[model samples]
Target chain A: MSAPLFNLRGVAAIFSAEMARTRRTLLQSVVTPVLTTALYFVVFGSAIGSHMREVGGVAYGAFIVPGLIMLSLLTQSIANASIGIYFPKFTGTVYEILTAPLSAIEIVVGYVGAAAAKSIAIGLIILATAAFFTPLQIDYPAMMALFLVLTAVAFSLFGFIIGIWAKTFEQLNFVPALVITPLTFLGGAFYSIDMLPPFWRTVSLFNPVVYLVSGFRWSFHGAGDVSLTASLGFMTLVIALCLGLLVWIFRTGYRLKP
Target chain B: MPIISIAGVAKSYGSFTALHDIDLDIERGEIFALLGPNGAGKTTLISIVCGAVSMTRGAVRVDGADILRDYRATRRKIGLVPQEIALDIFSTVWNTVSFSRSLFGKPKDNAHIERLLRDLALWEKRDNKIIELSGGMKRRVMIAKALAHEPDILFLDEPTAGVDVELRRDMWGLVRRLRENGVTIILTTHYIEEAEEMADRVGFMKGGRLVLVEEKTALMRKLGKRRLVLTLAEPLAALPAELDGWHVELESGGSQISYAMSDGAEKGAAQIIQRLGEAGVHIKDMAMTESSLEQIFVDLVGAAAGSQP
Candidate 1:
């Protein structure tokens, strides 16, 4: 007799299943986000673009584009990943995943990777939609892509953590809708911190999403309220923190083991 | 070789203990049944052995690899059918079972998958979503998933619970075949009858402790008993002095008399009939009742529970 072996085959298997599951509910996974992004552009971009002048050396329409993309990235990533993890617990499918020969890391990669990929796709769709509202430019196209992926990965991992921590369906929606969504709005998704008073501006800097949005904006416009170096450093720090938290949760089997 | 060896394994959730000071060694090619009532920690013990749940104290070795230190190795040798039927409803059974196999790092073996599906009578359902299958079919899928990795030792925690009788019988037969092929199976079930039917050895657990573990037949012979039930033609006012040596219960408005006898080399039903006739109870109808596995289980747990403070 030999001890079991683990390979990416298991990860791929689980990943394939998750992707299939997400794809099956194409309305929620695909159409809903597309419609939401359209609404965001129509309501926030077109309606608010005319009154506000260029705040970050970019037009109001263009300035909000990156924020809009990040908004979709964060919400979609979190929603997809959270629902992905939470549904299994709800339907009892999680037991199959947990009892499988796959390691926890493999489970994380399969689930969070699928979630991040989904978020990136939805964010890209929203970004594409932004093209109709205002002409967008990409100063650092490669960097922009990299930041988008990192942001999706980070937020998806965060959502994965939230999914595990949440016990019920309401608890699942509570944090993302109430906590993360509010933070994104206040993080200057549709506006810049420069317009805020000094105290509020200082306070806004504490929001991690601000750095993500600012970093993403800098990638597109080469202009942001925060320094590029600081934003990149801050995003890097956030990624590390998210990864560390996930690894610790996996190691501890937090809310995973019965 | 023993497929699994559990030493001093214990699991606790905060202040509440789930399993206490448990030790189990399961040999290859045998079905070991863990019989316990609900909340007796049967699932906890199996989960610990299968690497699904962590033990607070002690260790488990699967095929000589420590579960905690060498999880991949240990897990590869084991398959777990949890008490819950957890399946991705949207995914086809083929993908689900194949994924479970690959999760153990086994290469793509399509033939093996087909054989398993066919054996479990799931080949047609392989292309169907798990949610579409009946409860019995889904249970078979759970078994297929556990067998996907071809583990040396499989842990089935209440596998037949709540399942239809046909499916339960099918699962028992499948387990028997697996045993024939040299897979050591550890099963937890509330169905003592299932244990009696399928187990080569049985371990009874009560209050988080294994009360007894022995060969099935040896346990039955040592603890099994027979009760002589006598229906009298006339009501007996009292037992005669000749029957004083035996423990007898008067029932059915004193028209029936029962004598419980511990099984031994010399004791037989003939002796009870002779004793009753000699006592002049004027028996009209007589029958013997043999203790079932449940009776043995009840007796064991009842005695264990009574000894507690």
Candidate 2:
């Protein structure tokens, strides 16, 4: 008999498969982020915060906390999603997903959703750890959560794009390391964009990660060097752009066909 | 109605064409085998029909629904068992199959899931992680996953390539059961024996073009070559002048005569037997060896390649 139509059930299948794999290596997806966040708090929060004054009416430790959380969100989301997809490509298992009845949208939502969930989880862990170092008050918990999830989803989609583009394992890791890592660091993860001169501030504004970090930081401390509305607008556009690109790639079956 | 209609399908990677203009009509509830060598565009053809690959020029309809224009509807009508073994190693066999069913938007049906697992001889391994299974068992799990969705058409791409004999038998048996249940099964394989044993219709592909598509038995009878061997009661000293016109060879100390036939139109076999009788060589016994599906494939494909520009 012919199979039935597609719907949320497809998303669940894709998402469950993805989540099962990420859970397979809890040490990497979960423990590594926690440990790295702790290290950041120690080195950047205490060491750097000890000497440097606060930029936005918050302690250096608390100020860097938002950036650190955003960094974790962006990196983990991309890494988990990219590696999750890359393994299938290498093992030739991606054909299973591609040939299934599920639409390209379902595949993206499943993988990107799982990646966002992991990143959000790790981001929360970092946020909790930051609390141990410095007490911070949230201005809007709802907006923070929304921005956090959105950032994860957006970056995870971008990571999925990179995963699809990468033909080898080395290429998979290269983009996240060389491109994503450096961009996050320079996006004011450890500092504020206001400290830079006008020319550099304008340049920082161009970095998508800057808007993501700035918007997330604004949600947390109710203040940021860049305009919060502008950051939100940029993040929304980035999310749409990445989503559109992913859908197009999936529709075209680029690098996915036999 | 035909379950899948591939009309003038072609695929290309930049300037290189992977699949050329091709047309195929796969009826519902039959096992159709696509046979070809490596890079013969078997996978590309299946991919296009399943909507996994974009076609450069052509359209495919699954149960009358266009693959590209009405993808969701067409996709829901088929189940694909890809060549690659791509199960999440950490997931249990049961979970993987069940998840695959849900992917088709089917409601959770534990009984259906259990039945598919049982049919594939994977029920006992349901709780085991995919990584823990052997290669053959993993292949069975792939079959189970494909059947989970209960689609009208099931596409198996090299289902038994690395599987063991027993598993292959079990898989074939399962495919037969699926066909009996009215599932249109389209399978691709380099294993000629698989097509010979399981296919109702055979389609031979060469260099992206479908060279021939016919009933398995008809193709064999029409194009299948045969060798005739006759054993004489006494050894012959030399070749007879009357039998010189035949493509005959003497074997076993000149006691047997062998002749090859390209098709049924050749009456040379009867002539050979008549010549032996007329030559005062009493034939003790004789046997005919028919060409295997592999032989027919090689001959047809080899000829196609030789004729290529």
> How well is each residue in B1-309 modelled by candidate 1, as lDDT tens digits?
577888998888889988889988988788999998889989888877776777899978877778878877777778888888888777789988988887777889999999999999999888999889998888889889889988888889899989888888788888888988989889999998999999999999988898899999888878988777889999988876767766788888889888776766236456666777887668799887888889999999999899866
Over the true interface, candidate 2 deviates by an RMSD, in Å, of 2.8
Q: Model 2: runs farther than 4 Å from truth?
A: A1-6, A52-54, A196-206, B226-228, B237-254, B258-279
Whole-model lDDT values for every prediction: 0.84, 0.85
Interface RMSD of each: 2.4, 2.8
lDDT of 2: 0.85
Clashes of each: 3, 0
lDDT of 1 at A66: 90
What TM-score between 0 and 1 does chain B of candidate 1 receive?
0.92
Clashing pairs in 1: A3-B73, A4-B73, A4-B76
Q: What would the TM-scores of all predictions be?
A: 0.91, 0.90
